[model samples]
Target: MTAAVESEAPAEVLPGLYDIDAELYHSDPIPGGSLSSSGARKLATECPAKFKYWSEHPQPVKKEFELGTAAHTLILGDGPELVVVDAEKWTTNAVKAEVAAIRAEGKTPLKPSDLKRVTEMVAALRADPDAAPFLEPGSGVAEQSAFWEDHGIWRRARFDWLRHDGQLVDYKTTKSANPSDLPKVIHDWGYHQQQEYYLDAGLALDLVDPEKPFQFVLQEKEPPYLVVVTTCDPVARGIGRHLNDRALNTFALCRASGEWPGYLEAPLTALPAWVERQYA
Candidate 1:
C-alpha cells in the first residue's frame, strides 16, 4: 500500500509579494518590478529619474545581458536551454524564421560565434582546478532563485550555483579577467553587495551553508577566455553590507515619501576629487 502524503500549507508571503519562483521569474514582465540587488545598486548611485525609469518601465534584457545569460545556461544547465543560429547564415529567411520562432517561444537566441566563445570559456573553467569542481556532477543547486525580506522590503536573488560545501559560484563574463584589476571591478559592479545580499537570502531560508563563502568565476569575453576564481575579502563584504544597508534605507525613504530626486542642484565650479587629487 502507498503511504498517504500530507500537504503543507503555503508560505505566508504578503499580498503583491512573491518570493522566488524560478519557473515564472524570467518569463514575467519587468516594468514596475520589485527591488533586487542590481536595482538596489543602481538606486544607490544613479540619478533618481533613471532609477525610477528602471522601476516603472518595462525592461527587455539587453543583447549583451542575453549573451552573458546564454553563457551561464550553456555552462551550467542540463537540458537544451537556448536556440542558437550560425551568424554567417543568419541573414537567410529560414534562419530569420528560426530566430523569430525562438523569440516567439520566449527562448534566448544566440549566434554561432557566441556559442563558440561560451564553449571556449567553459573549457577554460573546466581546466581551472577551482572552478571545475564547481560544475561537477551533483554540484548542488543550479539557477536557484530566492526571495526574502530585507529591512521589511522584498528583495530577490537568483543564484547561479550554491555548492554543498557552502561556496556560491557565479559566472561572470568580463573584458578582462586579470586578478590584479578585479578589486575595482568588484567595487564598481556592486558585486560585493550581491554577495552579502545573496547570502542573506540563502542563510535566512536555510538554503545554503552559512559558513562557506562565495566564489566568482570570472571569464574574459575575448579570444583566450581566461578564467579566474576569486572572492570578496571580508573587509569588502563588510563594506558591501554597509552599502546594502544604505541602499535599503534610501529605498525605504523614497517609497514612503514617493519622492525620487535627480542630480544635485549645486553646479560644478571645479574639477572633481580624482582630478584634484591627481594635481595635489
Candidate 2:
C-alpha cells in the first residue's frame, strides 16, 4: 500500500481524492494540520483541549477493534491484512509473542474463532439482497481518502465505499443492528455528523450528487449477522450540517489563536430530568 506524502506545507496536498493507506490517512498528512470527521466530532461534542491531545497522541490499538477491523478487511478487500493466530486462547507466552509479531508487521492478529466469525459476517453481508448491490465488486472503491479545503481550512474524509454512481456507503459492525435501536446508536456515535462530514467531502470533490443521501450498512457481529441499510433523514442531516459548521468554526478559531480551551472552571450543574422526576 502506498502512503501519502507529508510535507511541511499543507498546500502540497492538492484538493482531490487519493488512494492512500489507512495508516497514512489517519496520521493526518496535511502538513500544517487537517481536521477529520472524528476530530470534528471531538471538537464539537467534547472539548478542544481533548481533541488536541488526541490528535497529538494516537491511542494504541485496542483488542476489541480486532474483530471489526478484520471484518472490514475481508468485506471491503482493503485495510490491514488479517493474520490468524491459530490459538484457542492468548494465555501462553508463545501466543502473546506471535500476536505481537503480527502487529509489528502492520497486520491485525485474530484468533481462529474470530477469523471464522469475521468470515461468516462477510458472507452474510454479501448475501444480503439490499447491501450486496452497494458493494458489488468493481462497482465502487473502498477506503478512498478525500481531502479538500472548506473556508480555507483543510478537511479530510476516508470513505468506506464510494460507488461510481455517487453513492456513499459506510459500514459498521455492531452488537445490535435492529432498526429500533439505530436512532439512539446514531446519536450516541455521532453518525449524523459523520454522514454530513463525509458528504461535504464528496461534494467538494464532485464525487457525490447533492440529491444522493449518505448511507450506512450496519450489521450485527453475531450469528446470522443481520444487516440494515439506512440513511440520515433531512432533519438529521440538517443537525449534522449545523454541528459540522460549529466544529469547523471552533477548529478555525483554535488554529488561529493557538488556544484549545477546556470546559469552564466552574460550570453550572444540572440534574438529569429523570432523576429530578424521581423526587416528584
Candidate 3:
C-alpha cells in the first residue's frame, strides 16, 4: 500500500510592531469576561480621583512589583505547562481579590455598557459552530511582555501566550456563529491592533530587529469556532505613539498640578474625554 503524502499550509502570522484600538483590550471573553464591568464602574465612581492618583504615581512595590513578579514566576513554573493557566489563575483570583479589598464599601457596583458588548460576544460565539477551535481548550496560555519607545515616550505591556516562534498573540473568545464570518469580524474590530501594540513595544525593547514578525491567535467560544490565526505586515505606529504620550502626560499632569480632585468629582465619562483633549 502506498502512503499518501500529507501536505499542510503554513500557519498565519503577524508583525511585531503596531497599535490597537482600546476596545479589543477591553473585550476579552471567558466565563467572567464581563465580570469586571461592575468593578471598573465602581472605580470610576466612588474613588473617581483615584484613577488619576493610580495613573500618576508609580504602582506600589506590592502591586506593580510583587504581583508582576509572582505572575512571571508562575509563568516560568513547570506544572501548568501552558502559561495562560497561570495567568488566568492569577488574574481571575488574585487580581479580583485585590480589587475587591481596595474598592470602597457603600459604593454600589455600577454596570458599564461593556457588559452588553461582551454579552453580544458570548451570544455570537455560541451561535457559531466553528468557534470551538478558537475557544481556549482550557489550556495553552503563555506569558509574554513587550517594552517600547516612541518620540521619547516609553511603554510596556505584559500578556499571556504567544506563538512558539515569539510571534505576538492575543487570545479571544468570539461571538460569530459562522466559521467563515470570523475573518471579517476580526478585521472589523481592529483585532490586528492587539498584536501590533505588543510588537511595537517589543521593538522598543530591542527584543527583535527588522523583519520582526508575529501572530494573533483567535480562540472562539462557539462550536466549530476553532482557532484562527493571522500573520500581518509591519506598519508605522502613529496612533500608538500618541496614546503613549497621552497616558504619560495624563499621569505627569496629575502629579505636577496637585489638582487631583477634579478627576474624582467629574462624571465617569468625562475622564477619558478630558485626558484626550489635554493630550491630543
Candidate 4:
C-alpha cells in the first residue's frame, strides 16, 4: 500500500527509514513483499510452480505460525494488544464469526493454549543465562522495517531484534532447541541465509554494527522449554552468501527473461544423503 519509505537513517542505533508498524509493512503489495530474503530463499529452493503459487496466493496462517507470532509478541514484541482470541476457553455457536471478528480487528488470532505456551516460553527464556542481555532495558529494537534498492531491485528486512551494541537477534519458537538438531533445523528453514541476509541488510541500511554478532534466540515450544542464543560460524555465513548470490542472480534473470522454471528438464531421482550409506 505504501511505496518504498526513504528517510534519514538513524545514528548508531538502527536505521529508521521505514518506521511503519509491522501490520502495515506486512500488508504491502507485490514487489514490496516480493523481494524479502525469505521470499528470495523460497524461490531459490522451490520449483518454479511452487514459487509462482506463493507469489499469487495468500498464505494460510497455520496454528504453528500463530503460536510463533504470539510467542514473539510475548517475548520480544509489543505484546497482547495485537493478540485477539475469543477468550481463554469457549464453546460457541459462532466459530467462523469470532475468527472473522479477530481478522477484521487487525490482530493476531491466538488460542488460549497458545498464550499459555508463550508464557511458558517467556519464563524459560528469562531463566536462561543467555537471555540476560536481551532482557535488559533499551537493549533491543523490535519489529523495525527497512527497505532499499539493491542494484536495480528493491529489497527489505523486518528485524526481530537489533541490539544497540550491534548484535542482531532472531527469535524462533521450535519443537527442538537441542544443539545437535539445530543444523538440520537451520538448513530446512534457510536460517543461515536469513542470518547472512539480515545482517547484510542491516549493514546496507546502517541498521546494525557490522563488526558485531548476529544471533538466533532459539526456544523450544515443548517442555522443558530449552532456550539458547547462537550464531552461525564463518563457513555457514559463506555458504549463505553464495546461496543468496545465486538466488538473486536467478531472480534477476527470471525477471528479465520472463521464464519461471520448475523441475530439471532431465529425469532424475532425488534421494536423501543417508541413502548412499544404505547402499554401503
Q: What ranges in model 1 sit over 4 Å off?
A: 1-23, 26-33, 78-80, 89-101, 273-280
Q: Candidate 1, residues 1-280: lDDT per residue as tens digits?
A: 1111112212454222133444455433233334677777887778767887876675665667767777777777732267777665678888889887876665788887777777887777778887788767576657655656655676766677767666677888887879889998898898999988888777766666666677888888776778888889989999999888887887777777888888878765888889999989
- Kindly provide the TM-score of model 4 when superposed on the true structure, using C-alpha atoms: 0.82
Report how far residue 148 has shifted in candidate 2, in Å.
Answer: 0.4
Best by lDDT: 2
Q: After superposition, which runs of candidate 4 have C-alpha atoms over 4 Å from their true positions?
A: 1-16, 27-34, 79-93, 135-137, 268-280
- TM-score of every candidate: 0.80, 0.93, 0.38, 0.82
* Model 3 Cα lDDT, one tens digit per residue, 101-212: 5432211111233223334444443444543233333333344333333443334454444333333445444455244775566445544444455555555545433453
lDDT of 2 by residue, 1-280 (tens): 1223232224466887888787888899897889999998888898889989999998867889888899888888998998888898999999999999998888999988998899999999999999988888787788888889988999999999888788898999888889999999898899999999999998887888667677899999989999999998889889989999999999999999999999768667879999999998
Residue 176, model 3, lDDT: 52
lDDT for each residue of candidate 4 in 1-280, tens digit (9 for 90 to 100):
1123333333333333465575555554334233677777887688766776776675755645767777788777553355557566545758666866776665677677777777888888888888657644467667767766677766667778777776678889888888999998888889999988888787776767777788888888888788877888789889888888777777777777778787778677767879978987
Q: State the lDDT at 49 in candidate 2.
A: 91
**Candidate 3 weakest lDDT stretch, 10 residues:** 1-10
Give Cα distance to truth, residue 259, candidate 2, Å: 0.7
Determine the C-alpha RMSD for candidate 3 after optimal superposition of all C-alphas.
15.7
* Best by the TM-score measure: 2
Clashes of each: 0, 0, 36, 0
Candidate 3's displacement at residue 169, Å, is 2.1
